[model samples]
Target: MPTHYEGSKKERIALDSFIKFMRASESVTSKLAHGLADYNLTMSQFGTLEVLYHLGPMCQKAIGEKLLKSGGNITMVVNNLEDRGLVSRKRRESDRRFVSVALTEEGTALIEEVLPHHVELIVEMFGVLSDDEQQRMGEFCKRIGLAAASEEES
Candidate 1:
């Protein structure tokens, strides 16, 4: 049943476009995930490594919150990273119970290598878009992401 939010043809077109855009985004992400699967990394683990690489050392609990995963999940991710020698966990000097996770040099290099390929794939996915359209789309995405973050905070 089409429950039109607005009684207009433009509204229908806009709604359809939005759904297609969302589906395309999901598809691209899935493809990226598949590309990285051969490297023995999940999306969550990639994200954790990325964060540590860029943001420096962060506590496991804080990283868990960032990933929106449970403490156990973060532990598992950390263990995997550790086994891969991509990241290292150290006990905080002030608190032995607190463990800070930091990307090893290997992890930094890995992300640097993976990032360009991932970005190239995304660009290829959007290659049909003109440069102006791509810039505008990027800006639009940033705005939407900020708005969503703000809403989540509230």
Candidate 2:
């Protein structure tokens, strides 16, 4: 009996490459979370602040949607950021039922300073790959993610 290496070589190579990519992503994200401690920001808090900084003021519900998090989860994140004086929630003028979230001056400054380092960290970790390789990897990952997501719809 012989070992059945039956799949196309290309498929095997792609699967191996994807496994390595996922491992690297997990490792890098863990390191990034640890690194954020210097700025006193947890991963979730940093993510929330980054979203607010980029999107400007938005309703609390909107932030939850963008983050792919539940309203309760967003509320906890917002509460933490608020405790740090990094974000503020204001009632929408048109409808008292809605509340808008905006980063405070402190939050803006914090994210501004941290973002460059975050980018640099990502680059330093993965910049070993050539531009073409990176592009190919991106396309591969995007296709995989889209395929997986589409399966849920079907």
Best by TM-score: 2
- Each prediction's total of clashing residue pairs, residues at least 3 apart in sequence or on different chains, is 0, 0
Q: TM-scores across all candidates?
A: 0.75, 0.85
Candidate 2 structure quality by residue, lDDT tens digits, 15-131: 776677678889998989977888988888888999899889897788888878999988999999999999999998999888888999999999999999888888987789998
Model 2 misplacement above 4 A: 1-18
Q: Kindly list the per-residue Cα lDDT of model 1 for residues 9-75, writing each as its tens digit.
A: 8888767767777888899889989877867789889889878877889999888888889999989
Residue pairs with colliding backbones in model 1 are none
Cα error of candidate 2 at position 153, Å: 1.9
lDDT of all predictions, in order shown?
0.85, 0.86
Q: What is the lDDT of residue 150 in candidate 2?
A: 100
